[model samples]
Target: MTKIKICGIKTLNDALAAIDAGTDYLGFNFYSKGVRFIEKEVCAEITSVLKREHPKIKLVGVFVNSSVDEVKNILDTCSLDLAQLHGDETPEIFAQLVPHAFKAFRGVPTDITGYEHKDGPAFLVDAAVKGMYGGSGVTADWSAAAELAKKYPLLLAGGLTPENVADAVRQSQPLGRGRCLRS
Candidate 1:
């Protein structure tokens, strides 16, 4: 089955609701620019709660081009199952960080150059805004994503909703290969 990751989780109530709805991953935005940004203390609280109450739900820390030390600091404080790089981070950065934690790279339509780091973690293909990270609520070219799926474990994350997830999965699936679609 394709994994479902619900992004922009802000409150404990919302997190629980998403978990109850069977979401495989819960994303917490650490980027200060995002409206969904949660304080470190709040993140710690949420992470602790999730660990004790809903251990199965994976916690993902959404970050921009933050330093390795900064990322490590956040991960050390929270129970993050993965770190999503949504900025201009290089493959080398990902390689160096992958050993410390699970890594995911966010890409836009033009960014899908079929170039991926050997040691990089998963790829999250999201809609790219001019001056913003994800949560754009826009749709990416599914055809391009379909083509990229053959090589990488592509996770579709742009403009996905309950209504369109099934179709996205069906259209993006490449025969025996599987791609992930996230909202």
Candidate 2:
């Protein structure tokens, strides 16, 4: 079965609703710019509640160009199962957090020539937005992503809803190889 991750979650009720919908992963935006940004204290409370009430749901922290220390601080405070990097963080940054983090790269159609990075943790290829960090609700070129997915463990994101996710999964099956979809 394809794993499903619902991102941009805000309230605990929404989180619960996603979980109830059989979502495998639940994302919490920590970036201040995101509309679903949650306070650290609120994140802690939600994490606590989720851990106690719904341990099956994996929790992910979405960040953008944040320092390692800051990421660690959030991880220490909340029960994050993974850290998602959604900025221009260097490979060195990904290396430093390897095996314990989920490094996400926003995908764009401009060449993507020098976008190679050493394979560390699971990576995501999300649709690129002009002036936004993420949550653009746009889809990337599945054909372009196919080439990259050949060498890396990839998860697709951006503009995905329950309606189109199945088709997206089918189109990305070659890249994903039956892996779950995350949007």
Relative to the true structure, how large is the alpha-carbon lDDT of every model? 0.68, 0.70
| Model 1 weakest lDDT span, ten residues long | 174-183
Error of 1 at 134 (Å): 1.3
Q: List the residue pairs that clash in candidate 1.
A: none
Quote the RMSD, in angstroms, for model 2.
Answer: 4.1
Who wins the TM-score comparison?
2
- Per-residue C-alpha lDDT of model 1 across residues 1-183, encoded as one tens digit per residue: 566677777778878888887777788888898777878789889889999999887787878888888887898898787787777777666666674433333443445343354432347776556676677777655666777666766567767766876777777752211112233
TM for every model, in the order presented, reads 0.83, 0.84
Q: How much is 72 displaced in model 2, in angstroms?
A: 0.6
